[model samples]
Target: MFFTLPLSAATISAIGGSTWSNTPPALGPSWDGNPPGTAVDILSGQVDEYLLSGGVPGMFSFSAGTYNVTLLTEVAGYAGSNQLGWAPLSNLATFNPIFDGPDSPIMKQTIAPLEGWAFVINTGGGDVFSSSSIDRFLAMRSAGSTNGWSVGVEDLRSPTDYDFNDQIISVEAVPEPTTSLLMGTALIGLALLRKRYTKR
Candidate 1:
């Protein structure tokens, strides 16, 4: 018999910041997607590199039109051919997307700074293996530009109070030894019980 467990929140927190160190240079437009700002651009290429460099995790924040946010997932290489070196989006059994913003039909007003909300991506699937959190916000296209829309990403795993613009956090991955030991002991005991029952 084999058993697998969803990683504990503590464990995920422990391995949260390791990816920042190996993150390549900024990929594209800055957080605003107009001109390069202090914030780094987290393009699909960057995500691919992060995964390839081992199971390192990092966070990126950007502000763009709501429609552009979907484009990130639709990027040809981002979701295809095991691009990120992680499970494909289609393979994801569940997603818990959290949108932090106001309640309004207008995309711009809905994503104000002080308001936000969270929702499950696919509730009908009824699978527990996968999940995601998406944070949305509205910002000007440029410092003075009037254009604005909801923009955010599906964060897989992250530390408490994770933010994209301010600083990129990375966590080192550490294998859980105690969990492994407990699992091994349980397996051995089960095997012994089966043998004794067969002999009887």
Candidate 2:
């Protein structure tokens, strides 16, 4: 005879596409697309790299558009003290804080027309790590959307577990009808060009 017990949320390391500690905290509104426990590829053994939107690692930007950011969860030792912010490309000195600990669990913010930007996570005690530095975060696409992403953070450096569940957030770039039409036209043009070239 064999005995098996079902797993509780506390026994899992990830849930709803975010990582968790032994005793997971309450998460925010569900962001559809990437389901929980899906395997998202990040650089092996590198927690500070981001490869989203076909952009350079550690930095990302969408075409002119407004985007929504949602705070998903915070499971770090400093969950009540850490902060999340954004800065212009390569400009850590001007990082602006948008979300902080002890705020609403489902807090949301809107950013407009970003071209060049990097995300940073600020842990207390003067520890601030930027995406550009390749030292404290991971960013990946949100399942199938072209402009949606999920970012996870480790928050600490001393005993970096690389679980990336310490802090998690979702970014979604709102699509414009005009932009969609233009993209369709451009894609058609490229297809025509490719067809002509192939015929030759």
Candidate 3:
């Protein structure tokens, strides 16, 4: 089965000193808990809910198959005053042993265990798909990273706001029909064998 996750995120603080989304607004809070210890389910694709936080990377398990991921939306601001226009977070995060077949121009890299790497957001949406320009290489404990986002996604900001919604990603794993058919055939054979034994 394929997984689908729809979420939003923001990184980087305003040029001037300010705080935006510091507190979960009336609209709602993305990161359920406190900073630096955000939940990892945001990318699990197991839930069909809107994810609004990203700090601690999740340990997502997947089988061998092409996964189609997309950036739903992205926004940045400070106290809702110096808010930047919300736009489609057109960023692409390609992992090693994987390729952005659709966005060929986009860049992809392999993440080592204990490595600290995160998905970067390109507000301009220019080759956000491409990793031409990237920041620090981080890792996740889930993937054997030396550490995880302890401060949360605050590092994305100059002062480090815990919004952690700069870039929301949804990954859908392609279905394998051949594998399903083989399993079905095996089950049928087992059932027939059981019936024969019962007759004896």
Candidate 4:
């Protein structure tokens, strides 16, 4: 399971500006109330649907694999001080920053099966917003046109525009051989355990 998120690779310092221009139009509205919608489900089809159940609306499940994350666009007033990180879905409080600023280069991160992680944006004033919540982040599939996923963020504590475009990112899955091997090894181990138990 892999994702390729490509944004503008540019930072916009202006607040409330049309920074969302880079966001794919197919993603639809910024604040649609329901997030991690049907599109998110499609993008993550590699994982069993059962794993995607029981999380907050914006939270998602990914199979154990290496994901290539890129900080495409950080268009916000707090773009410089804000940070993006991932935390377990069970615990949104545990945030590990992937990048300190918008200018950071592409990063590669590995996720474990059932680890259940979500993205979090920590503001300059220490305010934290999770993608698990609809108030902070809105996610949508790119209408199958880009074969990608996009997320729009509302950074302000008291948003004036409710644009939810403060931060924009696009994601697409990329295949990796190591991840397949890891999955195969786990399956083999499970099969061996089952055979040994059956003989008892």
Candidate 5:
């Protein structure tokens, strides 16, 4: 089936009831909303691309703000001509906030880094965007890849809208693969040296 990993303590800060687009890593979009900042419509695969709420672009400033993070999905372009599930949308993965609360509705679950993150986008029950509908969670390797994980609608409401995009998610991680590679190389070298010494 599709690639998947177990859940971890990793979480991506997300907001409910927001539209997001794939934006490259760099200073975030315009921030003229209210409060500390306004909702951003784009995010990039590069974690460093995002900045503090009002950081300057093209500079080494960490902009900070609660901006929207967007991820691409495989369902963006399906062969079907229906707005149903697997249909192609200009945008890959965009969520309309399935779960919202009085204090905060943004979803922040324990999605580990370097794992696939898929949403079970089904419209049923009293609400469509409720986390309860998020039936399936896949093991996505990285946030750079498309966010499409296939799952069934076991306990869904009536009038099934096959729009799997209903469950929106992205892969995120802190870059550290280089270190892992180096450590692996050292271990291999040590093993070879030990073998040679034993032969002598």
Candidate 6:
């Protein structure tokens, strides 16, 4: 799937300084409690509902697909304000990874685990801008023993006022129909052989 999440004013203030100004309003709080930890789910319909209910500025979109995301990179910029900036928090891993403001541009030199979560941080501000929100959009896919991909986002800013107009894209590989057919054939042959052996 594909999703676009715009940063909120509160998120900006949290990352950027209050003096940064040009902060957008806050978007309504709508997130699914999934992906474990603090990762929140910000689906499209939910965002629309929040907007209709008088939510804040900034918008995002998500699409569903069967692919594996081994790498994740954040666009360079502050979600709410220009003063602060968004940075990577940790290297991607199978377990829950935390991205704090202290670790900006958290880059992973190796390939990420087959399954897990990664977090980002907003830094460069103090006090009122200290908190952060968990804005997330997730996509999951799996077939038998193989694990696909799951992605999430955490705003890390307070409520009250913020913007959430950011974009996230996942790149992965999809199994071809031929590969699926071959696997299916192999399974069928194995089942037939087992049945014959049992009869014998």
In model 6, the runs with Cα more than 4 Å from the true position are: 1-113, 118-161, 170-184, 187-200
TM-score of each model, paired residue for residue:
0.22, 0.55, 0.28, 0.51, 0.21, 0.25
The sequence of per-residue lDDT tens digits that candidate 4 reaches over residues 37-111 is: 233322344322211112222334333333445554554566677777767657777876766764543444433
Which lDDT values do the candidates have, in the order given? 0.26, 0.52, 0.29, 0.47, 0.27, 0.29
Q: Kindly report which residue stretches of model 3 are placed more than 4 angstroms away from their true locations once superposed.
A: 1-63, 77-158, 179-200
TM-score of model number 6: 0.25
Model 4 score (lDDT): 0.47
Per-residue CA lDDT of candidate 2, range 1-200, in tens? Answer: 12222211111011123322122222222222223321132222222223432222233333335668888766566788888887664455676777888775578998763445556777865535443444355555533335566676767766554456666777776544454556777888899899999999
Please name the candidate that would achieve the greatest lDDT relative to the true structure. 2
The lowest-lDDT stretch of 10 consecutive residues in candidate 2 is: 7-16
Q: Please give the range of 10 consecutive residues that has the lowest summed lDDT in model 4.
A: 9-18
What would the C-alpha RMSD of candidate 6 be, to one decimal place?
15.1
Residue 147 shift from truth in candidate 5, angstroms = 13
Q: lDDT of model 4 at residue 126?
A: 59
lDDT of 6: 0.29
Clashes (N, CA, C under 3 Å) per candidate: 12, 1, 15, 2, 20, 41
What is the descending TM-score order? 2, 4, 3, 6, 1, 5
